[model samples]
Target: MTANKAVGPTEAIADFVQQADFSTVPVEVRERALAAFVDTVGVAIAGHGDGGFQTLLSTMRPELPTGRATILPTGERTSAMMAALLNGGAGHALDFDDVADQIYGHPSVVLVPVVLAVAEEVGASGRDALTAYALGFEVCCAIAATMQVREHYQRGWHSTATIGVLGATAAAAHLLRLDHTRTRHALGIAASTASGSRQNFGTMTKPLHPGLAARDAVLAAKLASNGFTADPAQLEGPLGYLAMYADSADPSAVARALGNPWELARVGLNVKKYPCCYNTHRTADAILDLVRENPVRPEDIAEIRLTLEPDGFDPLIHRRPQTGLEGKFSPEYVLAAAVLDGKIALASFHDEAVLRPAAQQLLRRVSRHESAVPPIGSGEWEFAYSVVEVETTGGEVVRHRTDVPRGDCRAPLGRDDLEAKFRDCVTFAGTGLDADKLLDELWQLETTGSAGPLLNLSASS
Candidate 1:
């Protein structure tokens, strides 16, 4: 009854795992591995008290003392699945995590949590975790590229929940040292575990998706490593991930650059400067540029208009956000905060701020329109000629067009900017913790033998 099909992402990635050893991995991949791991830790620390993070932690608390793994933000030990769930939720809580352009999702949201949880459970060193993480991130990106990702995501699926589940499976498989055959089983198991939706955006469920993916990945790997089996063609089969989730998928993109180290070299990872929707970044850039050039007294502006591609506007289409969480996906709310308040600080997303009269009034003056443009890939909307317009009291029009902006992979934030952002997140995390010391610990994470020091600091705070 087995129907043969071309190898899918699951099979392609499994082959690499069967043959790869620490010696064969390129040096650049090793370095990227280290960089991503550190970034994930930083974001997790900054997301400590987010409602989603706390809820996930509480849900997994019953599994504590399982003596299998360490949960970041709390040095508590738990089952590998439980640890992955908690740490993964923390990493994505702030929405300030890193993004891989090829996948158009937060790969580390699942990869780091699963790898770190498994590493700690097995007493694996930092080196092992870093190596496995690199492979996982690469696999995730390749599959996403092959999937004609934009189309897949537009259909209501969340890439981090769908693609990230596969990435987490790869990382867990690598850490568990699964053979090629068993790794395929892990991927197959993960296919069944994949689930999340874009409709959940702006709600507590959004962050929870990545956590669930991480936990599912851990469970998949453990089951596979212990001889649990699944259909080898789970990804390409009629009932598989691609067939079920995407209308069309190009398998060649997955195999084209199989061994080229594409992810580490060119895909370009972006770190977020703010914790809101990425779509709003273009407008934020333009608005900030205008603010710097002409301190438009908030009272002087008549109204503001923003134009974005349909795909870009789709995620942030919410008109009137009734809650702070909902405000995260509202372009109007984000723009209002940036222009009127002169900053989009975390406090701007609190309950009271979301319902503020001034915020709502400012939001009313602003209008968002979806442009008539075609997108090349998932999350890469038409950045060309995107404009934010401001009408002044004197009948003057002040406008800023964003081709790109700081913190984007194209116009990346420098080390100084990244440090500034980290400090800002630390401040938002509340006062008692020493921001400088925590930042230093992250900068030196690769050299640290275990995550013990970082976990200790987070727990104490």
Candidate 2:
């Protein structure tokens, strides 16, 4: 299959999403996509009662007109747009969602909700949803690849909401079965709605970014399906999305890399082991490693130093967090939790836990430094490396460097580990849903006739 070199950026992406074949997707890619689906669903269900999710629900649920889509765990049926907003926010509320290095943000959190909501609305099969997911993941990564990721990210545009809006639009458009022209219009419309700031990090608004993207994407697709119009050149034209958001935009990158080798198989998703920011995972892994190898009790620790890639430190926005949400972006809080508990768990980020006397004491001794050398990889790949040095009061220094965190594609979580995480998330949320059954259905998600049964399992009884 030759790449469509003649089409414009928006058209190329829209056509790809509209026409991609699920059977052609490699077995490994399909497996990874399903894993992402299961992981995202688990996280969304776990966020059922999150303050941010609840806030959005309270605001939007009452206003939404009647529809068939169900909000996970809550089981509130609403318009696809409303359900996408609610479920997307819930998926990311805890900062526990998965990440992709290529997109520089959470992909599944935004994409999955949009696909599921639209699929339910159209009564599309689970296979249709999975195909949309793979295509959406590809579109998000390809568009992100064309930009100066570090510069764009440092400039405060949250890629999950910004780039992810387009990805979600592609997914929703595909499931809506829009033709190439309408799909292009959907992408263009989504560009206008694409906006989020990293400045909102650590606040309820951070998760709201993806939620907003999901909602807007659904609206963009629905409107496009009904002949709503947008400038087809909105991606690369002067004063368009890439020009405004990116320091240097390569529009050709989008068309050039549409689907020769799917990004789902290439720059794969990073399934998170810890429930905090993906930025904090490598540090958490290093701390766990250091403590496990050498017995360094919290009391025996003198000082801990973290050396990270310069760009990698951008997302660790909170140095001294007063709230649990803030703590997720605080490397200091994560390191403290790791040393104190010997592991960072969902509960570790709770307000009471983050504010504990022991963790606070450790926070005071923790410091961060940026390395002179850039991270070993390209683009946002720099975020994958971290160096941790721990000095104990007993005059011993221990250091560990992590290039691949436990849940990264290079060292993916095994089936058992992923299942355990799903079960743990369900238990933590107190959603009372059957974790085993949900897991089974998600693993076989592509085989299901409709997304309704799978989505229903996520709802509370």
Candidate 3:
């Protein structure tokens, strides 16, 4: 591996991937990364039944080449690229996958599926998969820190797919055991292949972004392993990835924080408790809190005013959402559901529930506004901040403000909560697998010889 000074952003990342030792990773980071893997698999199983997953399956299942990689919840063997695409799409179909704060996107949904697919293809051990995930996550955060997230995200780019492609490439390269040079080429190739648009936020296309990113990264790594050529400086060069996607590029941030404290440890993952857009989480939490404390009923509510950061409000584009999918990005519906049920679950976002006359009546009372003041002590890239005020017909006013949501790393979900979520997802997917056995296997993934058992169990009915 070359020294950091001798390389650019792309090469620096490759060098780190080639040299980083799995044993040296901290216990907490590895545990968190493993938890993310478990969470993604659970979510993917639930997502397998989604319309988006069915569409991708129908398109790619027939064309896949012979291979050993398994698509989740289906147990169908297919090419590594096809498996990654299907599994990645499934993991994100519900918008329930874990998120990284620094990346400003869902990292596990993209990285985990690709690493598992490639690891299965090459017979890599579970420990190796864990290491590759850590490397991929670190690379994603390092690269994301260098960009102006608001500017980059506001430009209509889905950072999960755009930036996640590079991270997935790094993980695939590591699992393939590529040397520094090939790893660099893999990153370069992925840069050109990376693409996703936030314009598709409320549609089935939204989940497809991470799926395509996973497929692109696997293809990039395979091509690089076969001596496919690409610009060595594709990340920082003129007309490169950063320059093309982000409003401003800072290659130095990627180099300055290569692996000092490890981004996985410093800027941790946010495992969601709800299966909806992350932007609505804080408001949902606040509304749930208000309802619990004040005994507020849906019928009693006269108006609901939610003040959120401008960037936070941008993705919630469907103010008058009609479908369950669109309701994920609609604060109006999320809040109404929260107030009506006193809890929001996977079933809450269904079209039947979202279109209920009661929920629609409450939606009319909900209104959103942009906050004039920025959140207190928020970092440059941290954007989730909201204040919820509910006015009742009984002449009562209740307000709650939340800077950090319940499932955020700051206030993370407990082990029991995580387990419950996993069970709920497995049941929801109707996979009929024994949740206890699967959970035990995932908890002991690091010591397992191969990921085949886990994948097999997940795919089994």
- Residue lDDT tens for model 3, 181-222: 899899999999888888899899999999999999999999
Q: Model 2, poorest ten-residue lDDT window? A: 374-383
Models, CA RMSD each: 4.1, 2.5, 2.4
What are the clashing pairs of model 1? none
Total backbone collisions, model 1: 0
- List, residue by residue over 1-461, the lDDT tens digit for candidate 2: 23658766787797687567777767777888888989998999899778888888888756988888868757667888988998889999988889988888999999999988898888888888888898898889888888877778888889999999998899898889889888888888999999898888999999999989999999999999999999877898898888888899788878888776887887687899999999888899988998899878899989998888766788998998888999999999999999888889988878999999998899989888886563333335444578789988978888888878999988889989999999998888886788887887788788888635446663434
Q: Provide the TM-score for each candidate, comma-separated.
A: 0.90, 0.95, 0.95
Superposed by TM-score, candidate 3 places the C-alpha of residue 166 at a distance from the truth, in angstroms, of 0.3
How far in Å is the alpha carbon of 311 misplaced in model 1? 1.8
Q: After superposition, how far is residue 310 of candidate 1 from its true place, in Å?
A: 3.7
> Which residue ranges in model 2 land beyond 4 Å of their true spot?
373-383, 451-454, 458-461
Tell me the spans in candidate 3 whose CA falls farther than 4 Å from its real position: 1-6, 374-383, 450-454, 458-460
